[model samples]
Target: MTETNPTKVQLVQVDPELEGQRIDNFLRTFLKGVPKSLIYRVLRKGEVRVNKKRVKPDYKLQAHDEVRIPPVKVAEPQELPSVKLNKVANLEQYILFEDDQLIAINKPSGMAVHGGSGLSFGVIEALRALRPEQKFLELVHRLDRDTSGCLLVAKRRSALKSLHEQLREKQVDKRYHALVSGHWPASRNKVKAALRKNILKSGERMVSVAEDGKESETRYRVLQSFEQATLVEAFPVTGRTHQIRVHCQYAGHCIGGDDKYNDEVFNLAMQEKGLHRLFLHAYSLSFMHPKTGERQTLIAPLDPQLSQVLKNLSHA
Candidate 1:
């Protein structure tokens, strides 16, 4: 469907490319420039219809379903990210794997996965800028702003849907490496706790163990031990927000350089050993390929700074 008279209603038919997509999500693309509040307003007022019937925002559009889009003023196009920026241009060098359906990148720390919340652009925005002609690109999963690891991006809607199903089925495996200091017992290989997230008025998010919170579990294996720090591989059984960071804190071995959920004394001690950021990294991800149906395992090596901190501790 192409742009029509802004004052006129447009009837666009759904295609297989957007099959199974929610009505509200489809409208954002269809009615680009329309405010989100207005999109919901039209839906709530029954101005937007599917198959000549009123549908809720969550209605899944099907092939050939006609959508009645009410005329709404489109805003001026937002400025696109400049591809020449070093952060955007250099992303290609970080690509660990790529295929027809998806890509795997060893995301750098301190960069948000997707733009928003005061960030003008992020990895996804940069990727989109890099491939202007690519029709569809979306994140298969997200990594925290400070946690670097294997992040997935789908090239097609089908691929995104497939990978999401695999994740829901627990068929995806992700392993992370974290550097912490304290008495880490080999016998305490796993942490099973419930966590609750709290939002401070300052807009900061914090997660802590709470008996009435969501159940979480993480299995750990010691990689190396040192008087200053301990390196361990953590496998999260359930994907919860900040599960690994909070779990490490609960175990009394808070990850070094963790500004949140960290022990101040331990952080100061770790800083002396050259650890300056959250000492957490996602090392690998294993999953069945959405397009090929074959098992795929992707690995990301520790970055130079992180690797150097480990070396620094060895000699400290």
Candidate 2:
């Protein structure tokens, strides 16, 4: 794990592995135990500087750029509890691809990506424990906690930078398999709506379609239709929080087993059919190798339980 000296103002030079990382994310790692709100506050107040100039939270750091961090008290690092190690060992079996620059895993549903918000450990934390020798592992992108599928992790900083560029330019192709309530209209192949994110009083996050929200788009192709549900492929053109699930709801077909944006009666029906989790899986991803520029595509087959649900629906 990376460590920073917090007892005094320190100037650290960015390395190749951290190139193109957002300054705010970089600070979070450098200043472990500091709250995210404080990190943003520091950025807003110009207390954190890059090359002696204040930069926004989204400013990407370049190699050799000097970052000045002010002195701040951080909590003492805690030792990893023993039970977490056992959970991490299970992830070894899900590795779909691994190379010098990156690793791709078929992340399981119900597992958060990185620990926070009461989760003691997530995929990234477990991976870190599993590979203590790795110095620069980081998440390239994210998947919803209940959505299982192909997930990318960068082994080097340069690779992370390259992949971020691809995502920003929409050069990478991601596809998901989803089971939703109701019969989807054959002609309704695309959904374009603006989404705005909100936080409830309890700090829970939600998203809804709004006129003053960010533009979001999802392309849907019905793979199969049943009396009460439809199996479809979802291609999200813009990545927003809960984009696919919310858009499907907007189409009057909320994803099955989605408690946040789903119909309760429909969920009960899907549960009776053996659906135990959200029926959204990131089935495939296509992108250029950040190191070689060679195109690579990875696929994660549906979990057997999810497959069984589809079979049950098809036969019904």
Q: Which prediction has the highest TM-score against the true structure?
A: 1
lDDT of 1 by residue, 153-231 (tens): 9998889999999999999999999998775787889999999999989998899899999999999998888776788
Clashes of each: 0, 1
Could you tell me which residue pairs clash in candidate 2?
17-157
TM-score of each: 0.91, 0.84
- Report how far off residue 84 is in candidate 2 (Å): 6.3
What tens-digit string does per-residue lDDT give for candidate 2 at 32-95?
7888998999899999999999999999999899999988767677554353466688899899
Clash pairs detected, candidate 1: none
lDDT of 1: 0.90
